[model samples]
Target: MRRILAVLLIAATTASAAAAGQSGKPRYFVKAWLQKADKTFEHTTSWCGPDQHCLVPIGEDMIELRELSGSSYYLRFISASSEDTPCCVFRNGSREARLESEYPRVATLYYRPEIWGGRGVTKFGRLIIVVEDLY
Candidate 1:
């Protein structure tokens, strides 16, 4: 009876682990480019697996994405917002780019400096982010 109970417990644990791994969560590989104080760019890469949220750090700020499916993604830009500088995507140093879909694509974000805010160009310059699905 002891041997049978031990076997049953092990089997149940294994099945539960398998079911957790089979959960519908997706995984992602991310590459990001952020500008430094000297106007140069820096590259950072990371992975967002099923065990954690998809939060990519760009310098001191962070960008989060959720429910990424097809051409739709929910995005959030977290930065030092005391300056009230809005974060947006820029193209070719001039034109702005939309932060929409298509896997393995590049999106550049620009944080403009607030003229009257004391933050003094908090998170300035361009931030480029690339996302690839690894599920």
Candidate 2:
């Protein structure tokens, strides 16, 4: 009985969140700025929502970032989905890696920091800076 209620509650919350995302409320955005070898930059940005996959392509790979309702966020690499290879990672402002791991990690930012960002590396060792905004 308790388990059923929990499942139902989660389902209801997710459905409402999906609706809110389409309602034009302040949504989360995942922006990427990839530096090329010639010093030029390639940019891409996508809005995120609960249970939705927002992909920003970098070279042949892609950085996947999404928000869970308005509560938390998730980050990972699409190409590295089935492998243990580290394709991307969240980092602090100082360029120090923060949420580094061999696999995807669900990041729950209850405090809603202004910026929860990350970086992606291409096959040529170029840099891709990805920023996830709280609002």
Candidate 3:
């Protein structure tokens, strides 16, 4: 009886640990950019693929962009759905202007138009995101 009880306890502990790990949210890379005139431009196309896509929070979403100088920027939005499609926005200080939408799922070619001044080819860039499963 003692041996049986010990085995059951160990099994329970292992099951709990597995459950905890599964409950943790998964991390994903989200690529954001603009598309214009049937052209797409951006940097770091890690997450824009057929098997991979941007993961958005079920509720409110917050994204932070960190620069090489250690400075950061924040973007907050609600209802970022998978069916809503992907796009990029240009930032000018506190003002954010939407550039364009409708980008290829995984293609890494083409050039996205620059919405903030004639800054050559403006690639908004990529960001790592942790999305919570709000079932």
Candidate 4:
């Protein structure tokens, strides 16, 4: 009886974990680009995945997508708004991206002042926008 109960518990736990992983979520692993909101500037984050040369422009917003060590992805936004800039995420089909903080400050994302567009010309402070997960 004891052995049976232990086996059942382990099986149940494994099934639950599998279900969680199978949850429908978008996983984006591709190469993309970004241009500034103004015609005065434009940049890219070295390529999210492949440098196959099919570079596509996302917009004039100084931003890029990167994969985290945790197998998640995030968006890097350049802004200087202490008021917290809120935005939503959208993609063509399967690639999913979710906005992090509805109330974002400069440190909301990954802030690297040393990077290009790190010193954004926004009246607001450098915004460290964080996007949650490819899942």
The candidate scoring highest on lDDT is: 1
Candidate 4 lDDT by residue in tens digits, 1-135: 534533333333332222223223333322222222333322222222222112213233444444443233345443332324432222221122433322221222222323324464232122222222233
For all predicted structures, in order, the TM-scores are 0.48, 0.35, 0.18, 0.22
> What pairs collide in candidate 1?
none
Candidate 3 structure quality by residue, lDDT tens digits, 24-129: 3433233333223344322221221122223222123333322211122233322232533333443332322221122212212212343334555544343222
- Cα-lDDT of candidate 4: 0.30
Model 1 lDDT, residue 25, Cα: 42
- Residue clash pairs of candidate 3: 40-111, 40-112, 41-112
Please provide, for model 1 over 89-112, each residue's C-alpha lDDT reduced to its tens digit, 9 standing for 90 to 100: 343333233354433334444455
Worst 10 residues of 4 by lDDT: 47-56
lDDT of each: 0.50, 0.39, 0.28, 0.30
State each candidate's clash count. 0, 0, 3, 9
In terms of lDDT, model 3 sits at 0.28
Choose the strongest candidate by TM-score: 1
If the candidates were sorted by their lDDT against the true structure, best first, what order would they fall in? 1, 2, 4, 3
